[model samples]
Target chain A: MSGLQPCEILVVDDNPGDVRLIQESLKDGRVPNRIHAARDGEEALAFLRRQAPFESAPRPDLILLDLNMPKVGGLEVLRAIKASPEWKTIPTVILTTSMGNGDIKGCYEAQANAYLVKPTDLGTFSEMLSSIQSFWLTLATLPVG
Target chain B: MTQTPAPAISPITLHLLLGDLPGLATCLLGGGGQVLEWTEGAHALLGQGREEAVGRPIADLLRIPAESPLPLLGQRAETWSLLTRRDGSTFRAQLITLPVPEGHLLLMHPALGTPQPKEETVRELMELRQALDESAIVAITDAKGDITYANDRFCRISQYSREELLGKNHRIINSGYHPKAFFTNLWSSIARGHVWRGEIKNRAKDGSYYWVDTTIVPFLDASGRPWQYMSIRFEITERKRVEEALLEKQAELEERAAALARSNADLEQFAYVASHDLQEPLRMVSSFTELLAKRYKGRLDTDADEFIDFAMQGALRMQVMIQDLLAYARLSNTMEGTQRIHLEDALDAALANLSLAVKEAAPTIRRFPLPVVMGDLSHLTLLYQNLLANALKFRHPGRPLELTLGAEREGGHWRCSVKDNGIGFDPQYAERIFTIFQRLHSRAEYPGNGIGLAFCKKIVERHGGRIWVESTPNQGTTFLFTLPMDRSPS
Candidate 1:
């Protein structure tokens, strides 16, 4: 853990408030991490592909995605990441407010690393983010980028 | 002009003429108007046998006045005169004189101011024939299947002249609409001397189609063989048209009803989906307001704290209302989870779910035996939970609450009821209480989103049941519902 660099996390969400709250929650965690935000699924794809303006962006250690959005939805992004040879090794987690059975089943079938419903309670929401940081960033081993 | 001499008469010709006028009395007269022969008909009519009055003068037998001119030898005449019977009784008669080979044949009969019976019979036959021809399309065919008689109505309806119809069979009017078996059955029935009645489609000379209700009667000879067939027909084209139009209208109505049902189902599905999506934003509002109240209370001004509390309360209530709306819409969307379940077990599950409220209220509860019913078990549990929760929420403040749950078989259904000694409402509001979001009490008095009773009603109806309430203000209330014992899959 000492030799490793700070973890880079990418959060993809349409709502700016939700993205800010997630960043604030992850800041309280023990693991050293840097947060990068994409306003929607398209920007997240541009960052992942390192296109033009994002040519110097670092490969994200973990990706958090929202289900419902304006253009491309979370399920399609999950599928795109799992299909690519370069991005498939990076763990992608779905964190959305939809607790519907169909959404949960679809995300899992798309090879999402984990599925979490955004809790309505502020404490529970922060706690869920801390758990994701602890487990995906500190505990689990990943292939080096 | 000079008058021609009359030809001499022969006795044989006079005798043959007597047989011509059947059912009438006749006597032969010589050149002097004396009776030459008294026929058997005359004896029967005038009470005089031939032996008693064969040589009497025609005028003497008829009592004709002397001044009346006698009928001439070559002319025909008729006059009313009196006739004397052999018994000396006299009656008025119609005397007819026709020239014969001898002189004139005088025919006499009692004059009742009407035609003689023989002539009246012939006139009646002619009148009956005219009536049949005017009212019906009549046709007769000989034993060899050739048309022997066709009335004027038959020729008019067939669009053919009388000359063209005679000596021709009915094949000219065949429309070919009926199968071969139909005609075969008709022929066999008529050939067996049975009257056949049916509806037939026929074509006219102008190639127009028409429907007819027909009856054919066979006239048989002494050996029981049919000599001819008479067919009577009435047009039924208008009736057939009306029947066909009615069938088309009925089919159209059925299709429209099916389409309307499909649209209704689509609307219900839309409502369910819309309500489900509405929950996300509502949850965010509620969560943020709570966060504001928790983090800024006492740090902000007193007024700001109070305002945040109000906002939090509003968001929470809206969240509850939207959740209830989703539940109500879901009842219509997923009605397929139905099976046979024990009502007792369902009631137990409801009580278990409301254990906290039951422990807090400490209400006295009684349960009776319940029958097994075919329904969605979770829905039934929800129905019971809502009713029980209502009873607890509306319990009388001063007195201990009492609750009863019971069910019994009634015909093909089980009549189940939940009774409670609570603050009952007015009977007039019973029907409105089951409608979605209809509340009888203010939110300050009783806290509810007013959706429980609506759920109960929808669940019972989906299981082929009916639900209603009976209540008395300030006394008690009973919620009664019926569930069918057996149901076919829809």
Candidate 2:
């Protein structure tokens, strides 16, 4: 058996259904990965900074962020992530229900690694999450945390 | 009257007779009609004594008739004559003749009254010529239009010398601006003995152009044909230039006004496209619902599954509403395509589109006679569909749903009404109910995004019309709108 370490992914979304969907999609994905969840942008940033409750949490190799959330929306979190020297290397992908051109360009301008719109159909949404896992976590190599 | 001969007087007899007469004026003439031997009364009457008069001729003292022959010395003669004084006054007299020692001695006596006519016509003609030369550009052309006479003003304005201009046809100064027909008309007018007056643009010897207000008067001969033409001209080049500039400015202002209208139309198109871009986010939400329902269908518990089902339904409803809004925003883009539309046809289309909803509500639609109106064809269909759908959607729960669709002519437009016997809204919220996203009822009571009536209002207003509502708490609701009968641009 190949003894590669399991990839760590942090999913940030305000909707509990969307966060649960991401977790289910990754659990059924072909890659060996561990999925973490944050209910809002504030919690996602806290985990990324390893502060307090997140001190014992493993450093995530990837982040899937929603544009809209309860506090500290995706653009502010993306900016905070890229601005810090510690967490700047993590690949942050934007996944949201908004396919607006302004939102897409705003994320890219704020140094988001990639932008993707969440699919509405359950089958397509699972396929997209699996593809994200296969491409970012399974194939790509990451720096030591 | 013929001259009659007078009685003769002898000179020796006259000297013997007049020597004794003190008042007798006598002159001893030399061979060539000179005078001599003046008497004292003669010197006083003639104002010339013997010293001044002795060597002078007798003819100088008299106004002699040219036809009368002077008699020789010692000849008998009688004729009427005049004697002039040195003070320039003259008196009529009778001539007396006699023979003398050397020349004829003559006597004169006052006869009667007559006046001499003085000549002043030649001087008056000179003053008239000077006045014409100073004021007007005078030119005389012969019957064949050749230059005969041109005054100083004409020469100065034409920049041509008199020697160079004379005998030349009027064509030498033609600027070639006027067509042949223009000159032909002028010739025809002048040929019929009428004075031809017009403004002529003429070229000078220096190749510069000038405009002249001209009047050509034709002089006729005894045979009634024109013998010559006299032209009087005044300069009007400066006035013509100002008029041309004003016309150019007027044309420029019209062009600018047309450009401004085009720019306003472009801005309206931009607004329409920008609203169309909002559809993307609604589609994204719809897609998300489909994904959530498919992924978590049987895996989630009953409550979670039901909640997901509700979210999917809401997303699908929102998607439909946004499509309607997109169609509404695009109305201005097709405003140019609006034409005369029949209200009956619009209502038919609306009924077709809402047949499913109509079947579910089981509403009784009673349509009265409708009229034709002017509006965009597709938009008119959408307008009717929205109103009709609202009528069926908001029906009362207990009683069977009923709808009354009718139209009538109101002044210059067709006023249409869609009334429903539904759970009618309050009269206070009538205006607010038509606003987008402003619902009077919650989702449990009525499932809608509240955009239907707003679309109806926009469509009516864009067609140069109006839309309004009348309703009570539970009796019914009537949505009335107007559409212009005549084809008019929004």
Candidate 3:
């Protein structure tokens, strides 16, 4: 096997408060990576599709998504990205404010990589973020694109 | 006794001795009962006032006259004779002869009404008779039950003429609707001089049957012995007819209401059985597929192995979705199990189960004062599992996530919220996500069965509560649901 590039992560969300918290919580990762940001699912999908605005976008090894969004929701973006052959292989984690059974069931049916109910408390949110970072970066064997 | 007989007491002097008599008339009868001088009082008292009394013999004056009381007096002259005045008034008079002179003096005593008038008394009696005629029915009988009088109302109701019914026995109008004993008892009471009140069925003179409620009273003489019986009656046919109709309608309504309740119970039972039966096969499919993946991991080609993994994952997801559906169907049953549960402990257990995942995700989990709730524990546990696991599962590649859980009391319930900062979804898609198998992502992007929120919905409903969500893409997400916080028994 030839040597591969390091796995990259893409985060699609509009809230700066959430962006700050996620950035702060994911500290204990053992992977060689760069964390990128997209304001919405549409932007995230555009990045993955190698569109004009995202022409120099690097292929994301993993994606962390929000189900709710302006223009393109996390579920729609996930569906669009997963249906495209070029970006279908990337793992996506759905982080959303919905705890309803229907929301969870629908996310899985639409082929989300993972579904998570977002925690509001700063302490719980940090722990949850750190754990996710640890699991995906240290234990997970994500493909280097 | 003090005066000597003088002037031989002429006829005029004798008339003066009987001064101011109401019908005083002097009559002088010569020897051999021949009339000589007869006083006017004599003729005025008898209506033998025919002036023929002046010269007639005494025997002729005592003869019966067609237009006078003379006829009655003539029959029984010595004891008492009736004298009729011009106004149809009568008086009782007795004659005594003076032995030496062979003359007569009449002493008169009249019953008060005889010389007065019968005009007012006759008028009052006539009015009473008219009132009786207009009443429902009135009949009078002697103590022996033979008819003596019947008012017009009675005659009309019975279709009988007064001539035919005046002396007839009461049995002549018997309808025979009542047994013989009923009549015997009624007669027995009346014979004992007691009033008898009852409903009687009678046959009319024209052979028609009619019913009347009657009250019969016995009239008594001075010695309190029964002399006559009077009966008044009324008809009651319409009242009886209405009572019968009402009784029938009430019975029919009671029967219809019972049947409707039975049908409603049956429909409820059908829904419970249908959803329960459908869940069994889905569970079997998922468990076996999971087994195949665990057992045969490395024995297949890459594409084949991947396909199997995808198939098993899909089956597991389907199983979760079906279970959520079953939970929804059984909500009515779960409501019965509502009880107080320790939220602190429930949260600890949820964290414990996801401990490995929590450390792996490294999310900042903060919990505030959580309220205990009235809920089904097993269902609540399932709901908590999905929510906690969800918090840890969705994390951006580099950014940290913050989660806070809190509660507020409102409307007799605690509205609990779980907040998280990750890749939050948009507000518009919030309503669409909480349905069974309603996924918002593709298989390659996320790995989940997508039934967690549906389970939360079922649990909230079981507690007689509601759940909803609010979020903005790239912003934070918040989930809210309500539950009774103090459903403890007193």
lDDT of 2 by residue, A41-69 (tens): 89998887788679978888899999888
Query: Which pairs of residues have clashing backbones in candidate 1?
Result: B9-B101, B9-B102
True-structure lDDT of candidate 3: 0.69
Q: Write down the worst ten-residue block by lDDT for model 1 chain B.
A: B111-120
Error of 2 at B490 (Å): 23
Q: Which 10 consecutive residues of model 3 chain B have the lowest summed lDDT?
A: B67-76
Error of 1 at A47 (Å): 0.7
> 2 or 3, which is superior by lDDT?
2
What overall lDDT goes with each candidate model? 0.84, 0.78, 0.69
- How would you encode candidate 3's per-residue C-alpha lDDT over A1-145 as one tens digit per residue? 1125454778888765566556655544444556778889778877887786989999886788987788888889888877888778787888876666888998899898789866533456657766676676666776655
lDDT of 2: 0.78
Report the lDDT of model 2 for residue B358: 83
TM-score leaderboard ranking: 1, 2, 3
| Best-performing candidate as measured by lDDT | 1
User: Model 1 residue B294 lDDT?
Assistant: 70
Ranking by DockQ: 1, 2, 3
Over the stretch B1-490, how does candidate 1's per-residue lDDT look in tens digits?
9986765645545555663465568877787887777787788777777776667776666566664545644678887665666655565577788887666787776765444346466579679878888898889987767787899888888899988987888788999999999999999999999999999999999999888899999988645878789999888889988987999999999999899879967867776777777776766777677767777899989999889988888887877787787778777766767777889988999999999999999999999999888888888999999999999999999899999999988999999999999989999999999998999999998989889999999889888899999999888899999997745543
lDDT of 2 at B236: 88
- Interface DockQ of each model: 0.36, 0.13, 0.01
